[model samples]
Target: MNEKLTKEEIMAALNERHSPEKQALLSEGRVAIAGLGGLGSNVAYALARIGVGHLHLIDFDVVDITNLNRQQYFMEHLGMYKTDALKSLLLKINPYLDIQTDCVKVTEENIVDLLGDEPIICEAFDRPEAKAMLVNGVLEHFPEKKLVSATGMAGYGSSNTIRTKRLMKNFYLCGDGVTEPEYGNGLMAPRVAICAAHEANMITRLILGEEEI
Candidate 1:
């Protein structure tokens, strides 16, 4: 006799596709996104829909009028912490998502605490120095974990240039790496989102134990 799939069954089957292992690593995949701006916002939202269960959000900035251009923040979220605002939107998409917010500036001191047990980390810091600081600290602290950071997703040109490159073992870098607008650069929404998507995809693949995809 043939049996029908229930809601839980249907979702479980779909979840299995993300990671065949029990308690799907992807579904239980804990991740820490270190920025909550243009790239980070969309990345977090995309990961939530893709079945990422736990997320640790770290951001120290509030919504600004200038951020409305390409950032995910909307007019209604003005004056709100980016992490708080993103958490609200992410919860709306998937209430089951474990969204933990950290409205602190990541530094050498609090990085260890800010980052829980997430196996993968995404860097969305726009400022080069800030990004490097986090990257160095994480690498020094946890050499085994995977870290993906964006480099040069500025200016409005070809979307094709936005790509990902593996810098080393358990480390990947995404973005144009240059070709940004000269002084006072502007970033396009599509390009930023594309890069973030690649980073999220890499994180998913790593969690799945996929072979060097």
Candidate 2:
């Protein structure tokens, strides 16, 4: 990074060709992600690494020992809020990055407000009902915001099967939507990471305006 460049400026200049207008563009970009679980946690980490200027992460659930299997929270962070745990670690990775953390469950009533500011929305909720609520809420109140949702990724599967599908304009979903926790035989690390990567990849493309969704 250039000595004179601000964190934002350095990131902008560093990825100038792929990210135009320097910090100016990043300054205008913000992403809201619901759920800080196996999917959400990895998604946020990837976005932070990519130098997104701002992020709003939400999750009311507290970290547990089970989460260490696939989620980003550590053993030391047990009992910590997932949103708080993620925020604590993410900021350390990029102090210049702006993060707004909300330790609250995402329901239809609040999903709109929680997601209102960001141009892109990332759906990382593990439960089908909660994920559906967020998706429906977005479609109802904020129709234009780009969305990346993940589903059916519970079972042990090869990483290659996890892929991003452009469902429609501004809407992208990852994974085959086939696996379930009951039949998952159990969730493992690799599947979680693969699905998360697909979601994060779509998010980055949307942010850069490289893809419609």
Please tell me which predicted candidate would have the highest lDDT against the true structure: 2
Q: Which residue runs of candidate 1 sit more than 4 Å off their true CA positions?
A: 1-23, 181-184, 211-213
User: Best TM-score goes to which candidate?
Assistant: 2
> By summed lDDT, which 10 consecutive residues of candidate 2 come out lowest?
17-26
Q: Compared to the true structure, candidate 2 yields what TM-score?
A: 0.88
lDDT of 2 at 142: 82
Off by over 4 Å in 2: 1-27
lDDT of 2 by residue, 109-192 (tens): 777678888889999988888888888888778888888899877777766777788887777889977887874466677788
TM-score per candidate, chains pooled? 0.88, 0.88
- Residue lDDT tens for model 1, 42-78: 8898888776888989899999988887788899999
